[model samples]
Target: MQSIAIVLMGIVGMLIGWFVYSKFIANHIFKLDENFETPAHELNDGKDFVPTNKVVLWGHHFTSVAGAAPIVGPAIAVYWGWVPAVLWVVFGTILFAGVHDMGALWASARHKGKSMGALSESVIGKRSRALFMIVVFLVLLMVNAVFGVVIANSFVSQPDAVFPAWTAIAVALIIGQLIKRNFKLIPLCFIGILVLYASVFAGSYIPVALPETLFGLADTANWIIILFIYAAIASLLPVWMLLQPRDFINGMQLLVGLLLLYGAVFFSLPDITAPAFNSQTATETPSIIPLLFVTIACGAVSGFHGIVSSGTSSKQLNKETDARFVGYLGAVGEGSLALITIIAVSGVTLAASPEEWHAVYSHLGAGSVDAFIKGGANLIANGWGLPVEFASTILAVMVVLFAGTTMDSGVRLQRYIIQEWGDIYNLNVLKKGAVATLVAVGSCLLLAFGAGGSSGSGGMIIWPLFGSTNQILASLTLLVISVMLIKLKRPAIYTLVPMVFVLVMAFFAGVIKLKEYWLADNYLLVFLDAVVLIVSVLVMLEAAAVIKRFRRGD
Candidate 1:
């Protein structure tokens, strides 16, 4: 019953959040004008700016931002307890995330669909735009590297997922070709999904596990290299090709998988087994205040969500009113996924006896990525009587598959930022897609080697940085949106308060991380943390300057 209640609560909460956001925040506050022209229509290039179906665009937006964060965050942050994680995922999305996401979409549409980096120049100032661009570029670099690590690790952990995961690319390519050739939508969707599931099932019997080590590198590292090569190629392609279609298919898989878990829980109604709190092991657990805010970013509020909104989704929105659904409701979808994760992990862990529960969570990584795979798999298998090992492979494949989509998006966004930088400095080659892509992929490789090392241990070392930088990025994005709103003489406080709060929390978290890394002599992370903090502080200072001008009636 506990599991069922948790699932029900999350669904009801997200629906309510979706409704309130569309009605009060998006409709009343942003005053969404249905007839307003959008960038997708005005600049329909059929490549990057393809005017897409609202449903397809929502799937893309949701899956792109809906990658590993929501799954990983709650899985790990359950250290503080499932209750707090659940509360934050539910309320945080409603109050802060929905507004923040919609603000990005509305701001971008109103400003000709420029990314947050470009918007900084007009809304804040040119110098800060450069600063903001660097921040976004660095963050995306980490994003790509992290997803590479994630995909590689998924393959290393679950060999049965590999063949099916790779096969899905073919499915995406075929789907893209069909769409380009003007195939019927209904039949195509059915064919695509059918092919996708067939691949997953086939992959189970014909697992393609790589050797444990190759050329003196961990299998995970080797897999990371291969994944990046794919990302580099895929990222350079048109959105409608591999990126959109693959994401759409992955979104469907995710939807069906979650529904299966929900159905299982509703039927079985498992009891809560994990402790409601774990403060007794204070040394092992983190405090829930600033850490919780940083740790559980995507499920609640994330800066990257805004990036996806303003950078990609805004350009593809077919109508002005669609911004409400694309931005706010996409976030609500992410929140619901996070809530489901909390329930699955919490219930599964609680289902175990005390001795077994302790054994499961004994390791550092146990509560995080491992937990999501095992816990989520447990929920699905136990509920449906599926084989646990096979269902686990299915879930692992799902994670790696979405990780690919996100990495592709990250590299593409990085390319855009680099080209814009070239425009600022007048380097023609930089504007060239080939040159910009090389630079983007090259930077990703460097970051990958440093962050993951040969074995990818360094990836874990810098994991927390993702959450802090993510929230800080959200703060910076909100700052610009707030400035834009104030300039138009509308209510800016809707975005301002969350901006300030995120800025403070992320800034504090970064400082603490920097100190810890310095003391541990983890110079790489210490340097990374220093850059994140300095850039964020400068950006926040820029926000201050903008606010000052507004107060002076400028």
Candidate 2:
């Protein structure tokens, strides 16, 4: 009965989110002008800003938002309990994420495809724009760093998964090129992707030893080096060659993988294994609330989505009205993905005896996540009549591909942010692509310092901080959406409700983190927590100020 309720709640929530509430938000609040020429119409150049078919645009938008973070965050947050985690996915998506994403598209389209920072200045104050840009840049850095670690860890732990993963990407690139060049090779490309997926599973069984060059410095460190090298090359590559093609291919893989996962969970009808509610663990859990909000903030509501939604997607939008479909629908799809992963994790871990579960729970290292995902994959394979190990390997490949897409997108977005900062600062060095690349690379490098694999290490301690950062970013995102809705002289309730919800949750989380740090004896987490608290508070205050300004006709 409870499972039925959850399933029903999720379905209804998604329905309201997509067809009813989201449409209301779009029509009444956004007032998206159909006549207003979008970048696709106004700035079309047969490339990034060219108008595309709705399905193709949807693919682009969905791929941009889908990534490894959605998988990791939900996988970890289920530790809290399936109840809160599921609710977070449901309510958070409908009330906060769906609206925020649609609003971003509407606002950016209104501004002729100006990026979020530019939209911020037009909607909020000019000063707030700079702050928004900086915050966004930092968030992107953290995303790149963490995702980098995510991919590297997968490669190191499941070396056999690498060939199939890279092969899938190679296949995607070929398809993208054939489509671009030949125009009639789409069917062939699709066939190739299917073949490549099967081959990746086959390749996973033929394992080979990883070679170490600089004294036996552990396979993990070697993975990191290899990852950094890939990031460097991918960053330098054009979008058409590696990045875009890989995204298209992996995006399809992600969709199929998610569908299969959900089908497995649903058809198998696994019982929830975790406690329904565990407030005790919820409070002092390894996560700093603020940090967890930042870390897990991606699935529920993310500022990053706004950037992708507005930045690249606006150019390809067939209609201003379609923003709701691409942005809001995409967000809900992601939240659903998160919910599925969380339920799977909670079910598997809870299936074990309480004492055994507690032992694993207490010392849940990074390997624990890999194990959980593998276990879930195996369960699906067992029920579906497939090889368990092969299923697990394919799952690992999908995860790595997800991370790769995220890293490339992060770097590209960060590059643009750097260029924008350059324009704002009036620095001559910023004008040169080489200099902009340097600044962007430096930002990525700094973030890479903390990109240790997600093993609940000290780096994992930063997870909560990432969550906090994302919440703060979401607060800012909400402010932009609300103000833009107001500027269009639309009803503010759609924006107002979500704006208030995100602020309250984010503020509560931040305050909790600050209090914990103040009471703790350790200076490091104390300082880290303190820093997060201050930034969060200031950002919230700024968001409040913007909301007030919007309300007062300022």
Candidate 3:
């Protein structure tokens, strides 16, 4: 019953956000016009810049931005208590994420589809652009490397998901060709989903696992290398060929998965077993004040959203007016996923009572994606009468697919950033697509293997820094958008308030983590943390200077 109430409240808030608040922002703040020519039309090259339907574009944006962060973040943040996590996700989606994401898409589209880092130059200053790109690259590096580890981890732990996960790619490739040939999307979507689920059913019956070691590397390490190799090829292909269709399919699958999870909550009416505010937190758990904001980043507000909005989604925008649907609603979709995740992890399905709940979540980061999977599977088995094994496979594939899509977009965005640097410095070598992709993929590989050593799990070594760094990027993105709004003479308060709030929280979190890293003698994370903090401060100061000049009409 408590879980049901939470679900109802979250859904209602999101509805109001999408129908009423989003429309208001779209009309007045963004001033979206259907007559405006978007970059997809202006720079239609049949590759990265192809005009796409709002529905398909929304699918891509939602899943790519989602990844496994929302689930993993909320699942872990429950150590602080579900109330704080839920509040941040709901209000943050309405006030912070919706505005920031839509603003980035609009800002980038208005400037011919430049990434936020590149767009910073037009809105702020040249030095801000360089600084923004550095932050952007670091965030991308963290995302690509971390997500590869996440997906590889999933494959190793949930071998049953392997068959359906790879099967999704083949299905997407076929769907992509069909979409390109002018087939009706309605029919293609149905067929693709049917095939995907059929594969899921087959996967449950036949689980696959790699040998203990492949090529003298651990299975997880081999999977990480293989996943990146796949992502590199997928990134270089035409947007219509793999990225768009694959994300669309994954988006639909996630929607179905969410409906099932939410339905189980309502049908079973699970009680909330976790405390509203934890009284027995692990002694090492940091203060929830600043950590909560950064811990549950993607579900609440994330800097990575702006990167995808401006980098990939902006390039595929078919209409300027569609920004509201693709951007705001995408945030809404992810919030809903996060909402259910909180319930799935905290409800009776996970623990019969409060004591059991605390035992399971004895420490920060105790219950992550695995907790969500187990709880969600139990819910499905209880409510829908499905076998837990099959339910587990479905949810596992959901996480893998979402992470896979993010990897695709992350690598491609990294390539775009590298090529932008090439243009800025007059280096023709980096301008080539293949060369840029190598650098993007190569960098992530270096981080993974170089840091993790034999396990290729080095991404996890830097994972703790991701939350604070990602939110800082989000605040910086909001800062860029706020400055743009002010320059246009429109009301900028919407973006400004979120910017100040997120920056302060993320900055504090970074400082806290820096101290912890230093004490632990993790010099690599300490160095990376210092770099992000310094770059963020410099970019903020540069933007402030530009805003001051703009206010003076200089």
Q: After superposition, how far is residue 443 of candidate 1 from its true place, in Å?
A: 1.0
Alpha-carbon shift of residue 344 in model 2 (angstroms)? 1.1
**Candidate 3 per-residue lDDT over residues 1-554, each given as its tens digit:** 88878888999999999999999999998899999999999999999999999999999999999999999999999888989989999999999999889999999999999999999999898999999999899989999999999898888888888999999999999999998899999899989999999999999778889998989899999999999999999999999999999999999998999989988887888899999999899787899989999999998899999999999999999999999999999999999999999999998888889999988998998989989999999999888989898898899999999999999999999999999999999999999999999999999999899988979988788888889899999999999888888988999888899999999999999999999999999999999999999999999999989988878888
Clashing pairs for predicted structure model 3, backbone only = 303-474
Q: Which RMSD values do the candidates have, in order? A: 1.9, 3.6, 0.8
TM-score (C-alpha, index-matched) for candidate 1? 0.95
CA lDDT, every model vs. true structure: 0.80, 0.67, 0.93
Return the TM-score for candidate 2, rounded to 2 decimals: 0.87
The runs of at least 3 residues in candidate 2 whose Cα sits more than 4 Å from the true structure, single-residue gaps closed, are 1-5, 33-35, 45-48, 182-189, 206-209, 213-218, 232-240, 279-283, 286-295, 348-350, 353-356, 363-368, 447-463, 515-554
Worst lDDT 10-window in candidate 3: 454-463
Predicted candidate 2, C-alpha RMSD: 3.6
Clashes, model 1? 5
RMSD of 1: 1.9
Measured by lDDT, the strongest candidate is 3
Itemize residue pairs with steric clashes in candidate 1: 1-269, 273-350, 274-350, 303-474, 452-456
The collision pairs in model 2 are 290-468, 291-464, 291-465, 292-464, 293-467, 294-466, 294-467, 294-468, 295-466, 295-467
lDDT of 1 at 426: 96
Task: Assess candidate 3 and give its lDDT.
Answer: 0.93
